[model samples]
Target: MADHGNDPVVVIGLGRFGSSLALELARRGTEVLAIDSRPKIVQSMAGRLTHVVTADSTDLEALRQLGVPDFYRAVVAIGTDLEASILTTSLLVELEVDDIWAKAVSREHGRILQRVGAHHVILPEHDMGERVAHLLNGRMFDYMEVDENYALVKTRPPREYIGIPLGESNLRRKYGVTVVCVKGQDEEFTYAGAETVLAYGDVIVIAGKIDQVERFAELP
Candidate 1:
């Protein structure tokens, strides 16, 4: 069995998403137990993570031997091999791991993972596609969906709102969004206030419902 710090995350599968997530977590100093059935993959990641194991994640005995059940959180990032992905997720749920995050290749796959008790199912490709589409449709420097219908957007201050104090800009009433923070050409981002002025070169983060944000981002 692997030795890990308190509440280490168990990551099963060493594919692209799995490896990237494990590496990032390790880089951030989070204890991670990374598992992959391929010996070569496990060997390649040996020194980078807290622990690396080569074992069949779909097999309950293998998981049990590796002490996966003791993990507080687990991520199944199997990119292909749907059966392995589903079986691993089911095994994790059966072990009663507190949180299970599974990756799905399709909507149907995501639904199935959810039905089988995966706490969270992420479709990375689909999410990336949607995010890219949003970027392509507007002048936004970046856009992040804060929830189903709300978002946080980074963009250059619109010309109409420049040089005016945020309080009198009618942004909330007219555009249905609020500037949460601003970054000037030479300064770090700071919380925006009623008296904050939006200069031409300033960048701002705005928050609002998705539709309102899309409209706001479309401004000239």
Candidate 2:
């Protein structure tokens, strides 16, 4: 684990999501100070994290005394407890923490967190929806929108094109899309070149105008 000199991170809840994030951050060598009102919850994660405090984070003074304002950025992740989450976020802002990230259960909740000075509001459900949509859309292993007209796309090799050489297929000439890399079945990926061979289960990462990529994907 290597520290990146990030300000220590404080997580204000010990529920599934918050606990998981804290553990992951700790595993990555980031100093984490976790808090939960429930003694049992805090106790369970003790020793694994840098610090675990059993205190209500909505209390501004408690947060300040814990050195949250001076030593760490904080995340308010109290899902299902809307009031607590909002209060904690407001307190963190008042205390002037360097940065605050919050999780919201709905659009209205997100708006409120943003209005209260949360630097980032994440809607996990909404993000998961986009991931699911991409998985269901064949020819799209993963897709990131760069703009209205361009995107970076990852796709499995089209059935008819497997075993073909990059130069012979002339994918760029035919579809105006460039293959950025090819991930083969052996789990090795190489930047596209004339000598690269497409194999079964290979995934191709391509970047181009959105419509061109879509047109290319549609080819068998």
Candidate 3:
């Protein structure tokens, strides 16, 4: 069909998640059409976005009048009103939008959104809570779950791993994790290799199963 990858995105709702997503997209120079049922919210975002409209997202005609169907991507970020969120997502699905992302407040909401044809359902609160929990211990500098049960984590090299070349360290064999990249205290991040020696104050990003990576990070 068409290459909708770079097309402008239509974002519905103006709550924390929707507003943040729209603003960030616009800041990155991406054209964004932000929609909300409240006039004040639309007014607040008038100059901040490419286009801001005060209209009911659940109304297909209203969306059509704003040219939402012409856009390739749509995000239904109405987290509070379940009926409105579902209706908006269903309309977008009927419009055959190439990519539909909807935010869900809970697991049941997410399931409904997926059943209604939202290509992607994001539980922002749940996800953020999980991520924050992982970073709370201070052992991990950063963490991203790549897939179910798999994650990539940035952490300081374990005490025993300090001053040892990766090949000789046998990290993957011993800890069941592979160091993907390393950044020394005084050097920029670089792709790690077998001969890469990790020293104190160095940060390394490793990839492996979530439990194994957690275990490795807790090594003494």
Candidate 4:
């Protein structure tokens, strides 16, 4: 058995989503056991991941042989095979995997995954669509969804917030958002405090509900 001690992650599937996710995790220096039922797909990902194997994840015996339950995290990235995806997730659940992150094609798919004990369900296309819309609209420099209703927003300080101390801005009170850090052009993010002054080119990272964050970004 490989020493997968550092919270190794198992990824079931070798489709676009699965392959990309496995590659990213592997690149980050995390131990990733990447699996797929297709031989060519497994062969293509051979050296790109920690370990790539060909096996039907829907088979409970196959998963057990691969030690899927031993890993702390598992991601179900099965492509368009919804039945296989759900079955794989179910097998993970039966084996009592600690954290299961499953990708779903739609909201209903996500709900079903959650119903089957997936710790987190992701609608990649829908989530990516929202992110793309936000980026194209130029409403914020960057946006990250924190949950269903909240987000972390990064943007240039509004004109009025410039040359003003963070304490006096009352961002949390007035805008229902909180500025956590600030960074000047070509500078790293620094912790923002009450006396921290905002500058013209300063980028502020704030967290709040999506609607409130949008309101804050609209500040002129």
* lDDT (10s digit) by residue, model 4, range 152-174: 99988889888889899887898
Off by over 4 Å in 4: 1-5
**Stretches of model 2 off by over 4 angstroms after superposition:** 1-5, 142-152, 159-178, 193-201, 207-219
| Candidate topping TM-score | 3
Cα-based lDDT at residue 143, candidate 4: 92
- 62 in model 1: Cα distance from truth in Å? 1.1
Q: Candidate 1: worst 10 consecutive residues by lDDT? A: 1-10
Clashes of 1: 0
Model 1 agreement with the true structure over 102-133: per-residue lDDT tens digits? 99999999999999989999988998898899
- The lowest-lDDT stretch of 10 consecutive residues in candidate 4 is 1-10
lDDT of 3 by residue, 1-220 (tens): 6676667999999989999999999888888999999999999888788699899998889988899889889999997999999999999999888899999999999999999999999988998898899999668988898888999999989899888889999789988999999998889999999999988889899999999999988876
The runs of at least 3 residues in candidate 1 whose Cα sits more than 4 Å from the true structure, single-residue gaps closed, are 1-6
Ranking by lDDT: 1, 3, 4, 2
Q: Once superposed on the true structure, which residue ranges of model 3 sit more than 4 Å away at CA? A: 1-3
Look at candidate 4 and tell me the lDDT of residue 96.
96
lDDT of 2 by residue, 81-148 (tens): 99999999999988888679999999899999999899999777776786577557666878776765
